[model samples]
Target: MKADVIDAEHASRVTKVDSLLPEIPVLNADDVQLVGDPELITVSVGDSAGSGLATCRSVPEDSPRSSWQALTEHRLELKLAGPEPVAAISALLDQWEVHLANVARKSDIETAAVIARPSRDTIGSAELLQHGFAPVVGIAVRPAERLATTGPVTTPGVRIRPAELGDLPTAVHLQLELQRYDAQFGMTTMRAGAEEMVTEELRAQLSGEPTMWIAELYGQPLGMVRVQLPDQAFWISSCVNAARVGYLSSLAVAEPARSSGVGTALANHAHQVLEEAGAEVMLLHHALASPQSTPFWYAQGYRPLWTFWQRRPAVR
Candidate 1:
């Protein structure tokens, strides 16, 4: 098929599928480049032709991509413009496998992933699982209206305070701890010079819009949470329908403070801040397999909006 005809078909199908899910917005096509020798792969669903597109992205270790982006060095992203039959989706996935074989070594791709709305999970789950992908992380969201009905999480003697320039050391330490814990689940990585990078990032964030907060017990820091207001969060906010969205960038409680409600207190504080700032929804990413975070975030009123199904080491 000609590239223009295929592109037109792919756009129509994508729009059709996206309109079905009011909660998940369509991904920007500009961010993904078309790949494969023929570029567009197609399969038949009954009488109509269904199409799929593949895009590969590489994030250098020093790339400006943030840590929350799943720290994988390279990614093979597969997109099927479907309200089509699962069989057609599966065929496209098969083509992706062949494409993976072609570029896995040369690109040094680390992971192959499909970012799917939770409502569509059953659509291509069988093929995704058979292709060695696991639902590794969830992009969870909490609506702003829910915040008004929720009360503060009270943990006596635990107080949340805004972070200042002087708090950089403690902030960086807690941030790295969060990264280290998530790394074990393979959703995040602590790269070389991570500390320095984190230090600089936090230093700037502390001085700016997405405020950082420190949780204290007996006047000593025990936990921290970073929240990006709507402006700073716009990049991720595009994925949701809300007019104003905020992000819970990072949150961590020290080992000694775990289960002591320090984490809950910090989260509640972030909720109040975003709600007061007029954010219509809050979003965050949590490791799917983490014993602590998965339940913690859900308990805090967030629900999985999207699931990132990923296969590590892209080819094998």
Candidate 2:
């Protein structure tokens, strides 16, 4: 500031000076976002028809993810003819995390998950876990031919037989246990009126639609496992190539019968029964935690080709 005195010497005028502001760098879009060309496993990029059903979450439209190159969503697709699926593994995985986070944010999804099955070009199970996904369930497969070695071991006083229509009332009750067992592991949501819902479903399955096997200890219903030829693509299909797949859709043992080799016997019996009918492969899904399924299935020579990994996040 400068002051000038007039000849009258009674007043002074003051002049004020302003300083320039310092430069602040602004964030550009590239600087603020995830990597370019993220490998996205969505219906939008590749074959959108059958990416398979994601187990732990649903991907609705209007998700926050604005970028990605699509990957297979279902049924283990490996197409070498398309654009380069992955350029750099590390960069691609980083983008996977970003993609999951964005979808979680935008879709208001509680959990995000994906399925990894056998493929020549794929992020292997170990690598899949390394990128923040955890294996929650597994689909195990065994060739029907293997049943000869595991099967027909008759447990004294325990007989496995085909379920009759007369067994519907009791079997429906056991089916409730099956659904409750599934919900116990968070494999499925525990919906209201679930008992009523499953009662209706099991009734349909028992009415000649599925070959239900009931394990009995001298006419006592100890456990049950149902074997059916898959009518549709089960999302896992070395079995489909065999032209017939023996799918073990539901299995539940009574509280007193678990670990007594009843479930194992039933599985083997189911496998043997299916094999006789010319099924070339046997398949079943075991929740990693509930139904106490993992150890037993592995022991029965069923190795997992696909593992479902899930994690629940706070809703935004």
Candidate that scores best on lDDT: 1
Where in model 1 is the C-alpha error above 4 Å? 1-38, 47-49, 64-84, 106-114, 117-120, 146-153
Candidate 1's residue-wise lDDT over 60-107, tens digit each? Answer: 566434354433323433334434647666777777678667666533
Q: Write the per-residue lDDT of candidate 2 for residues 1-316, one digit (tens) a residue.
A: 0111111111110010101100111111121223233342322124111112111223222221111101112111211111322322333344445555544454333334444433212434455556655566566677766525655777777888888777877787777777667655646554546566666656777776548888897778888887776553243344223456677877888888777878888887877877876766777777777537788787877765445554433112
TM-scores for the candidates: 0.83, 0.64
The lDDT of each candidate is 0.71, 0.51
Pairing residues by index, what is the TM-score of model 2? Answer: 0.64
Candidate maximizing TM-score:
1
- Candidate 2: segments with Cα more than 4 A from true spot: 1-89, 100-111, 119-127, 146-151, 230-241, 313-316
Return the clash pairs for model 2, or none: 40-69, 40-70, 40-71, 41-71, 51-73, 51-74, 52-74
RMSD of each: 4.1, 22.2
